[model samples]
Target: MQLPDPSSTRHPGPAPYLRIATEEAFAPPEMLEIYRRILSGANVDPGFRGLMGFYMSSPSERAQHIMRCLTDMDALRLKHMDDCGVDMQVLALTSPGVQVMDKATAVSFARIANDYLADAIRRHPTRFAGMIAVAPQDPQAAAKEIERGVSQLGMNAVVINSHTQGEYLSDTKFWDIFAAAEAHDAPIYLHPNSLPPGMYEPFMEAGLDGAIYGFGVETGLHALRIITAGVFDRFPKLRLILGHMGEALPFWAYRLDYMHRATVKSQRYDSVKPLRRQPSDYLRENVYITNSGVAWEPAIKFSQDFLGADRVLYAMDYPYQHAVDEVIALDGMTMSPEHKKRFFQTNAETVFKIPPR
Candidate 1:
């Protein structure tokens, strides 16, 4: 909650890099209604529903303020960006966004939500960018939305907040989205949602499912699912972005490769098919990781070195982890100006095809 002054980290001379936060978030009120209804009706544990119910209700001032932040794109947010020196924001829908809704609502509401974001970005192209929200509940419609969101609306990236219900992205049911994203050359941002229904029972009491630990586990598994399930093989040119430093995956890159080669080759899981490249290779080549809500420099350093600095990006994870101190810390990374430029600005330009600013 305490925000540091952005001016504290600046050098006496000009700024070193232009910061473009890739995981900036916003949620339309209409989308919130859909999530409330879906969560209430979902066949999950009762306790988890209770927690979601409380979260949906603004029980405390902090909760209320957070909700306000999600919907407001006024001068306050821009001031925060200016205070933190963030040049542009790739605004994606918040977690569980339309991902939890029923087919009809998800389809209709996602369009409305994305259209609002597009209009907002159009009003301020220099400071803000848009990311498409596609509801996987209906894959065909979702694919079309991807096409429209990219070509028609000029949104830079596609964002799906982790799984839909219990089904992950690797399932063949969602291939149309993968194909559309690849064709359009827009990277899909694989954000973290809460743990799928059944799994949340264990963590609901302590609230681990909402990003303390479960989000990383669930999202890391989702990315791994895509890699192992041949999603990348099917759409080799498709690119994916992961927040929280690849949801804690890059640190174990070698272990994943070693284990996959030793075990997958020897005793192939029925679920995992053959991959043209190893899991680590797909991660290095096709995946871009962002340091969102993850201020630890060691993780960023390791991710840049291991995944290649070209594959690493900067993000503030706004409204949730929007601490000014995090930005100051990231600006102080011990790397060359070129690597910092790539992390802050160039990687986003190349990935999102953002026009000259």
Candidate 2:
């Protein structure tokens, strides 16, 4: 199918836009080497080996794969922006976030990653804005880095990968980090990574088919934990953004609300706010969901219906999925021009606070 030309007279200038979530804009040689090591070591599992084989066919192909990964980080991001008419991108640290390491290692890696991202934004300020990566393992350090990232680096928000190395965001231990984020008025964008070791080992043992099924399930549960823990109640201004269409939470929203409403016998915790409204209500109010991996029209429409158009934003998952295809899918969907405008451009601009061009 011929996609509509965003630049055509029918579409006029700067047709709406698309933005990417949790993309590493710069992968230094050292970083690439680290990723190569990880990918190579990740082959301990036959399923992982097969996946890596699909990604890296030959020994000579490793460099190209690494370059492709880096290009996916930067050049391909821009190429997608051009193809999708994305005016600006809110870039963030890629998966597992800074949570996967010990405190010292996490702090060091967060600094390195944030510095690289900051430098990339400096070089392409118009095209990219940054999201700081925090190591919630150390709340005070995370708070300090967040302050530096925003005040010093001009980063717009923070991107956290789903569970903090198995410690869910709702854990009281990380309350200080949430408090700090609330203080800064910066949104937290939560992206997903592999499930913590034993948690999803059953699925992995049966070959990696579970990755597609389980990652979203685990991440969705993590997001739900935040809601149940009343994180939003304490930090009313704290904004949380979830990618991959809220990791499939939108579809199960009604069930969540029903379960909460039906459980009156467990009212022993009367001090809690009673979850007074629908679970989805908190999601609509405190969370912003991005269209990253799932680009289907029905899913988009359902997300907008559940979260509202203003809470939805365009996001190309990148490397995993092509931006060109995402643009074509979105353009082909049947939605009002106004809703499309909000989904494609306006909402992200408002959320990320991107300056108008």
Candidate 3:
């Protein structure tokens, strides 16, 4: 059951770049308990019920292995990072986070999780940086927590596991969270979760309701929702970090800009509003993406070329899809050393405001 010790397999001597994994995940034990409780309760999203039901009690070895990695914030996690040549992991509270809880519970759990993350960062300042977890169930409270996380707890950013109870951030009720993020200059990392109810059935029937396809579909849709809703225009200073390569947005630049313009012009969808810039312009201007699960050079390079080299950063998607060969593959990408440094190191620093090592 032991994960491979990649230290012996890593390339010898000093690496030319630092690997700051931006989409890495960790969860406090209490959060997992919340998930367990939700499984037996009503009003739970079916997809979440399925996903956690499997993870919590599945006899599958992979599930157990991932559980160990997800719950560990100290020695085991650090050992995995060292083994894989990851210099640092920008830790985030894992998917669904406090978003799955009721308002009161969500708010309280967020505070607890934020403090836990703050402690982890303090314990290993160089090896770890964190994104604040907040419950979007209560946007005002979420905003307050973001302020506290950034100004007081030293969190690098905020992590929202997309869609709170099937409600996307595009809703104006959630704008307070955006306002807080903008004021603090803290980037919001939009991580993925299982599809919500109403949209979960078809995907689940096909067994695609988890990472294979659903996560990207759900999160990409959420990102586009925010873009077309004019959240970026309203909060121009806000920066959004999307892992899995901008949730495939960079790849669809021409289509998004064209369709968005067409939709707005035709007034086909009354919800589509006029934007100050093209949909893709916002991607270039206000968004940064991480190459998390994707290790393919062509996709990574295309995202960089399309979004500008500065916009794409490196990530290991640790404990979930962390593989030594992925790191080697990214290391071998066809790019200048300067670009590589930015890909693996500087871009994360610039986006997350990580201090120089």
**C-alpha TM-score for every candidate:** 0.92, 0.83, 0.96
The best candidate by TM-score is: 3
Q: Kindly give the number of clashing pairs for every candidate.
A: 0, 0, 0
After superposition, the stretches of candidate 3 with alpha carbons farther than 4 Å from their true spots are 1-13
By lDDT, the best candidate is: 3
Between candidates 1 and 3, the one scoring higher on TM-score is 3
Give the better candidate number (2 or 3) by TM-score. Answer: 3
TM-score of 3: 0.96
Which prediction has more favorable lDDT, 1 or 3? Answer: 3
For all candidates in order, the CA lDDT equals: 0.83, 0.71, 0.88
Q: Tell me the lDDT of candidate 2.
A: 0.71
Off by over 4 Å in 1: 1-14, 38-52
Error of 3 at 18 (Å): 1.1
**Best-to-worst ranking by lDDT:** 3, 1, 2
> Candidate 3, after superposition: displacement of residue 112 in Å?
0.4
